[model samples]
Target: MYHESVMLNECLDGLNIRPDGVYVDVTFGGGGHSKAILARLGEKGKLLAFDQDPDAQQNAKLIDDKRFTFIEANFRYIKKYLRLYGIKQVDGILADFGISSHQIDEPTRGFSTRFDGDLDMRMNQKAEVSAFTVINKYPEDQLHKIFGMYGEIKNAKTLASAICSARMNAPIQTTGELKTILEKYAPKFKEFRYFAQVFQAIRIEVNQELEVIQEFLEQTPELLRDTESRLCIMTFHSLEDRLVKNYIKTGNFYGEPQKDIVYGTITKPLDAVSRKPIEASQEELARNNRSRSAKLRIATLSE
Candidate 1:
């Protein structure tokens, strides 16, 4: 399978799709969600999907529905692209944020810790920065910050120092070479987790995933048609989930809300449909291990 859509039914239910309402799938990795959305839509309904990955573009090409349109750009520029398409607002927007299964399964992509590919983790292959550049060219302090902040890895400073020292011998060329260095610093029995964390950190930096997510989310309020419009996002890590949760609860990346001093009214663009994030069911967990860490949060425009 190119990618199995996690929480598929849950996501669809959260969307509460209208037969004739327009929708946007911001992360059209495998087109699984988009295909399902199309199935639920009427002839007049439209679905626009976005992906920067060339591989995904190919998958998108396989779909020949007149109601569907694929945008070959990053979702961060959602507003600009939508405006260009003459779409100012949509009924709902869905985002599944993280690396795709196809990217990880292909060793050349360098997204999986288990793979031995070139350290190239750019979501958009054309992007200048890659995991190779981050590991070999970044300064020790910058690496330290990336590992500590993005990966949430302890001893990040030590790991950064080790990377700087080792790369001086030669540029860290591949995932295997990087893993060899990481194995030394990884915890006694937690090497796999450590490697995943480090690779995730580097990947995040290379793709600027968090920044893109924020920019994308910031544009969603204006893009949504009204309070009935939904925004459903699935995040794989705390860093991503935090941003989504905070934005929904407070209308900013920060969890604190901005209040009007005169009337003491809190200003937030979106309201959470559920009090807490929704996780996969036991049945789904049994089928896909990747769904274990997945969290789904649904929101709507605040009144």
Candidate 2:
């Protein structure tokens, strides 16, 4: 499998799909969700999917359905692309965030800690900034911030100093070389988890994943047809889940609502369907280990 869709049925139920409604799958990695959406749609229903990764684009090509149209672009520019296709609004929007299984499994992509590959973790292969650039070119203070903020590593300052000192001897070129440096700073017996956190921080910076998610979420209100329209997002990590949760609650990333001084009304674009995010079932957890950390959040336009 290219990538197993986590919380598949839950996401579909959250979508509340209308048989003839127009929908979008912004992160069409393996097309598992997109294929399922198409199965539930009627003849008039249309499913437009977006992906910037060339590998994902290839996966999309195998689907030969008139109701499906694949857009080879980042989801951050979703509104602009939808307009080009004469689609001002959609009935539902689904986004499955984080790196895909295919990317991690492929050794050359450098997404997995177990694999010794080139330090290149760009979702879009054509992108200039890669993990190599982040590790080699970024300053020590910036590295400290990325490690502490994105990775949540405890020894981030010390790790940053070590990386700078080691790079002074030679440029950190490969994943293995970086891991060698990380091994020295990593906590005893928790080295693997530590390595993953550092790699995740670098990947997030290289792709600007958090920034893209906020931009994509900000556009959802205008794109949704009405209050009936749904927005279902599945995130792998806390950083992602927090953004989704906050935006749904307050229509902002900060989780702070703008109140109308006179009427004491909170001005927000979207409303949460549930107070808490939905987690994967025990059945799914047994089936796919990757689903363990997954969180599904649903929202609709505010009345």
Candidate 3:
């Protein structure tokens, strides 16, 4: 089970890649973008790819090309990894931010609501925390906030109460087990969509995906070359999209505030490429349903 990169052609076109310049594919799932970058590069060009999942290494296809290098690490450490490789900056950086299809389709991976497996949703296997730990160990208040804030679920407090209460009877070990407990709290006549949302929230917290993206976005300007350095990010959910949108627009998660007479402030380090995000074309959406939620945002580092 491997992930098909969403909006593949559209992202490549947005990058405006230079044939002889260095590039980075930060979320190298299935190595789809990395492979495309490889095809577009000349012998003098280079592409560096990063993925925390070891399984992703098997999907990396450009091992034979000296122009390409794959690092088994998170994109949040892109600057560090690049520095270690004697590289300082890249012409373009592409990030497809979300869980891979491979993780969701594999039942044991437990990333999907449809799966009935252990509640282990660590994208990086080395991470100590998993959904099981969060569900069973986190305080009720923390769980309530995560569910309500990330999942945007109604009655988040009630749902949190149910989990805390049920786990005391028996440890919630698997997705199926947790689903059974949460289902009771779910409105009896409500659609299945609500339950799915709750599960998604848990997965997000378990992986610390939002925090990682926040760190990664903060470093893009420092990692890219001064002129025409493109940063393309594809986010599938509202929370993730909001972070990307704000960062691109104001160079901070919060919108920029007016300058005070007592303190001076400068403008952002990058400029938004489009006033709004670029959505996949109708043709692309029809071919891939997963593309439906994807919003692509691009920015150029200030020179």
lDDT order, best first, reads: 1, 2, 3
> How well does each candidate superpose onto the true structure, as a TM-score?
0.99, 0.99, 0.95
Q: Over the stretch 1-303, how does candidate 3's per-residue lDDT look in tens digits?
A: 377788888788878889998999988888888888889888899998999887788777536789989898988888899999999988999999867788778888777778799989888888999999999999999999999998998889988988999899889999889888777777777647777788789888987888989999998898888668799999999999999998877778876643546767656777888898889889888887888899999889865
Candidate 2 has its poorest 10 consecutive residues by lDDT at 98-107
lDDT by residue for model 1 over 17-83, one digit each (tens)?
9999989999999999999999999999999999999999999999999999999999999999999
Location of the lowest summed lDDT over 10 successive residues in candidate 1: 97-106
Q: What's the CA error at residue 118 for candidate 1, in Å?
A: 0.3
lDDT of 2 by residue, 149-196 (tens): 999999999999999999999998889999999999999999999999
C-alpha lDDT of candidate 2 relative to the true structure: 0.94
